[model samples]
Structures are given as C-alpha cells and as structure tokens.
Target chain A: MLWTVMPLEAVLDGSDSYEPEYFDVPWNDGGRLIVEKLNMDSARVVRLISGNANDYLDASIQPGTIIQYAPKNQASKQ
Target chain B: MTLSPRQRRSSSARRVRTTPHPALQEQPKTHTQEKEKGQDVLQNIQQLGQTNIPQQLSENGIHTITIIGQIEGHITLPPQNKTTKYEHIIPQLVAIEQNPKIQGLLVILNTVGGDVEAGLAIAEMIDTLTKPSVTLVLGGGHSIGVPIAVSSDYSFITETATMTIHPIRLTGLVIGVPQTYEYLDKMQDRVIKFVTSHSRITKEKFRQVMFCTNQLARDIGTVMVGKDAVDDGLIDEVGGLGQAIAKLQSLIKARESKGGSTDALDSDAP
Candidate 1:
C-alpha cells in the first residue's frame, strides 16, 4: 500500500490511470503536492497541484514513491 | 690527523707539529652511519606515500586529473562526504592548459554527481582544452558525471561501468511556480544541449532516454551499461585504463605530427 504522487501529465497522457483499489482518495485539484507534516514512523498529509505544462513543479520524486506507469506506447518507442 | 705519504715526506715536521682543524678531520664510518642511511631511505618512501604533497613523476607529458566521488560547488558538503572541490579542479585545469610540458590530459571520472553548475564548469574546461584529452569512466558516471565523461575528445568506459542519464535535480528550498518550472526546463535544456553537441547522440534521443519513466524503479531516468552507452552514442567505446591510455598516446602522437609541440617550448624567447 505504498502511495506516490502521479503527475498530471502522466494521468492526462493515459500512462497512469486512477484506480479505486490503489489509492485511498480521488484525484486532487492541484498539479503538484506539498507534504505538510511527516511522522517518522507512520503517515503524511500532502497537497496536490493542477496539471499544466507551465505549472511551477519540483521535479524531484521522493525515494519510496513508486509512480505507476502503463506499458510503453507503441508510437513513442525509443 | 694523518698526513699522506707525499705530505709526510715533503713537510713531515710541520704537519706533525700542527693540530688539524675539526672541520678538516675525517670521521671513521660506523654501523650507526649505515643505519642512518637506511632510515633516510625509509623516510623518503614515507614522505612519498603520505602528506598530500605533489611529486613530479619522471618527466611524463601526460597529466592525469581524477574526478572522484561528488563534485562539490560553492557550498561545503558534510565532512564525511568524499568531494572533489571545484576550487581545486579549476586551478589544475588552468595549470594543465597553460603548462607547455603537459602535452595531454587524461580525466578519470567515478562520480555520483553533485552541483550542476560545478560539473558543467569542469566539463566545459575539459572540452575546451587545446591539448589532447581522454576520459575514462570507471565505476558509475551518473547524473552530472555524464557530461564530464563525454567532455573529453575521446571517452572510454569499463565493461561494468554505468551512466545514469536523468534530468537535473535541485536540492534545498525550491519555490513551486511557473518561473521555477521554466528555470528547470532551461537548465535541463542546457544539459541536453551540451551532451548532444559533444557526443554522437541526437537531442531527440537524449531527451527520450532522459525522460523515460520505465527504466529506474522509482525514478524517471535510464541507466546505461558500458557497451550500451557506446551503442547509444553516448560514450565513444567500452574500454578500461589501458585502452584509454593507448588512445591518449595515439592522440598525442597525432597532435605532435600535426605541428603541435610534444615537448615544452620557450614561448617567452626574444
């Protein structure tokens, strides 16, 4: 039950789809999230950001947050 | 004092009467003298091993600059961290560039990356060297290390070496705003531009791998192995120190043949 923030672009691109079984809550309005408080042994509260290319976003991802991704798109193969 | 045969025969009476000065007297060699010589040799070895003093190697024209651990910038990292300070590196680069005796520069990198600006500055210095230079990437050349590795005229990586191509990461307090995003975007562009311009990789290909989300488990970047790096046109070849030195020698030879002075010449001659 590890929770991670999925960027708005990932969700909008269809690479990461929201699922009821994985997350405890529905998608938030913001494109980014700010962690308000952190318990060394337990939990945290985060705020979300609205998805936009111009949105000021911190690119760094936390260590344990596994951002889920769909299989590679056939058109975007490297 | 004992007089020689010629002195004794010619001026025996005078020599026998006069007392020799202590400075002119010869002391007999003893076991302690031999032991002292041995101790001096050991002390010389100890001096060469310890005490970060720079000793000139036997007149070799090749200068080796190692970029080990983290490349530190303006801020001081914790004492426990192994950091290659930019202040130290910048001067060495200048010396290597200015010194005529240094005909070639060999840069060895095994960094996990550090400040983006520091790494780029080092890379730029290496890229702009007039002397032939070669880069050998040992261990891991991750993050900003990638740019330094490719900055040399030729680059090599061991079979087990790896390079991580990821977007620029910022630490400390970061403001979340469109301007921040724009700043990050421009910084990313700078890295991509430098890498693409120096290496064989296309900008599109570099960006693709840089932004790839499938490679790292929790991170959004790609880790390329030795031969994979060469295949992807990031590094020149998969080789170790021996190959790297050979390539450097060849480059130096080629440069010399093309009218570049292999030996230091007096530019100040009137």
Candidate 2:
C-alpha cells in the first residue's frame, strides 16, 4: 500500500540502497506466487525508481491490482 | 723513542678516503635533506619531553588514540565493563572517515581480548572503512584480538605484546539441541571467514593456531610473542609507537597521492 522512488543506476550496481525485501514484483490481485518457507524467498528491489522499474509500472492500473514494476522518473510525484 | 714510520704510514693510509665509493658519490643532495628532516622529527619526538611526542606531532593532522584496556563485548565488572557499542563507535569511525583533517587512524591496544562477535565486528568495520588504520599491540591482544591485529592497513606489536589464538569459548548454560549447535557453528564460521579473508593467514594455518592444544592450560590454543607474531604473519612489524605513526603517515601519503584528502585525521571529538 506504499511506494518509494529510486534510481535505475542503483539496481544495476547490485548495491542494497533500499531496505531489503521492501520492493517486489507487483503482481495482479488475482495472481498468486508460490510461498515456500524453506526456499528463502526474499524480494530484493535495489531501489531503482527512475527508469527500469518505474517506467514499467502503471500506478493507476487498478485498485485491487498491483503493478509489477517501479514508477518512472517523470511520473514519480504524480 | 723508536722510529715507527711504517706503523704511522699504515694508520694514515687507513684514514685516507680512497675516492669514496661511487654509490655514495652518486647520492643526490635531496637525499641528505630528507635525512636531516627525519632526524629533526626524531629530536622533536624526544623533545615532547615525557611522551616526548613533540607538541607538533599533530602538526600534519596526525592524531592518535590509545586504547589501554581490553576492548570486548559487554560484561559485568565495572566501568571497564563498558562494551564498545557499534552505534557509539560507528559514528566515530564514520566521522573520522568524513573529516578532512584526519590523515589516518592509530589504534593502540592493551586489551586481554573479549567478545569475539564484538571484536570481529569492530575489526571488520575497520578493515573495510576507507581510511588508513594502524593497530599497535601493547600488552596483550588475545582471543579475538587476532582479527584486530590484521584489521588495519598495517600493524605493530611491542616486544612484550602477547597474542593468544584459541578456539571460541562460551561460559554459560546453553541450549543442548542439534539446532542450537548448528547455529553456533554457523556463527563461528562467519567469524573465521571474516578473519581469514582480511588477513595474511590462511584458513588452514588459522585452524592450526586456533586448535593448538598446549598453549593454554585450560584450553587449546596458541600463544605467540611479539616477534613470533610477526614471523607468523599475524603482525606486520615488531616496533613501538614511532614505527606505527610512521607507517600511518606513509599510508596517508600514499592515499593523498591517489587524490584523497588527509585532513579528517585532525580529531573527531570522540
């Protein structure tokens, strides 16, 4: 229910600029990803908000749905 | 009364310089200037009077911190029991790194060594911090002190400094389960990995030292004196404060040559 902005260069560098596991692939509400405790499944979004993740995301997609990408640098404030 | 002209001639011949060695003749005049500067600095240290560090030792922004007690994790004893916290020291270390006056850091240790986790944590933090650091072992750097010795860019141990490397030991009741034992083993692995990676000693050599059976009466470990520690590659040199400071200066100069600033070394105000 929250969103943060980040730069694309940060994720490419593989640095942990964001809090670990905070960002993830925002799947649609009807979709479900497998959750296994033993698999050590932890999402690591490198806080790439500007280009890569952001451009691929659609914030106004749907209320009950989640976008699977970060917000673009241009529409960040929106 | 006897005419000993031959003996006199021989003595005079010995004193006569036969065209000084070519190497000495080729020496640059600047070399002499450098030598004189070094001598002046030595005299300055002597003039500091007691600690004999000339009042100007801090001239070039070189500051020194002397840790005269054991630096380990929290324990019950008294004021000395104060465990150097990560939060407390992290800021100091960061400040030192960011300060423009501090050219380098000198950590003088006289600890009996405590808290493997805390000790390794500090050592690793120093190992990675982008600053020239030098550690001097004064009295004893035992147990987890092994990592601290190698954490700096270089290290010095006094002739009397003693370092003990022993297997990890815990003094308390523990959960007697397979999972608990597994967790403990993993934690130890983390420590050993950090130590071996940042130091010259290899995993096998470290294993031998950590498991030596005859060193401690109550535990299996190895005790290395100053020179031995250096020979074993635990400490870089067997020297005193001057050598340590000199090494720090050299490193600072190297860093400066690489376009980094050396002013942070002035003082971080604790």
- Which prediction has the highest TM-score against the true structure? 1
DockQ of 1: 0.01
DockQ, in order, for the candidates? 0.01, 0.01
The CAPRI classification for model 1 reads as: incorrect
Backbone clashes for every candidate come to 6, 18
- For model 2, residues A7-49, the per-residue Cα lDDT tens digits are 1132123222211112122233422111111112211111112
Interface RMSD of each: 38.4, 35.2
lDDT of 1 by residue, A1-78 (tens): 000112213212321221111111112343332221111111111222334321111111111111221233458755
Best by lDDT: 1
Residue B117 accuracy (lDDT) in model 1: 86
Worst 10 residues of 1 chain B by lDDT: B8-17
- Residue B69 C-alpha lDDT in model 2: 37
Candidate 2: tens digits of C-alpha lDDT, residues B151-178: 8899999998898776664334677889
lDDT of 1 by residue, B31-71 (tens): 14656445433433332121111223226677777776667
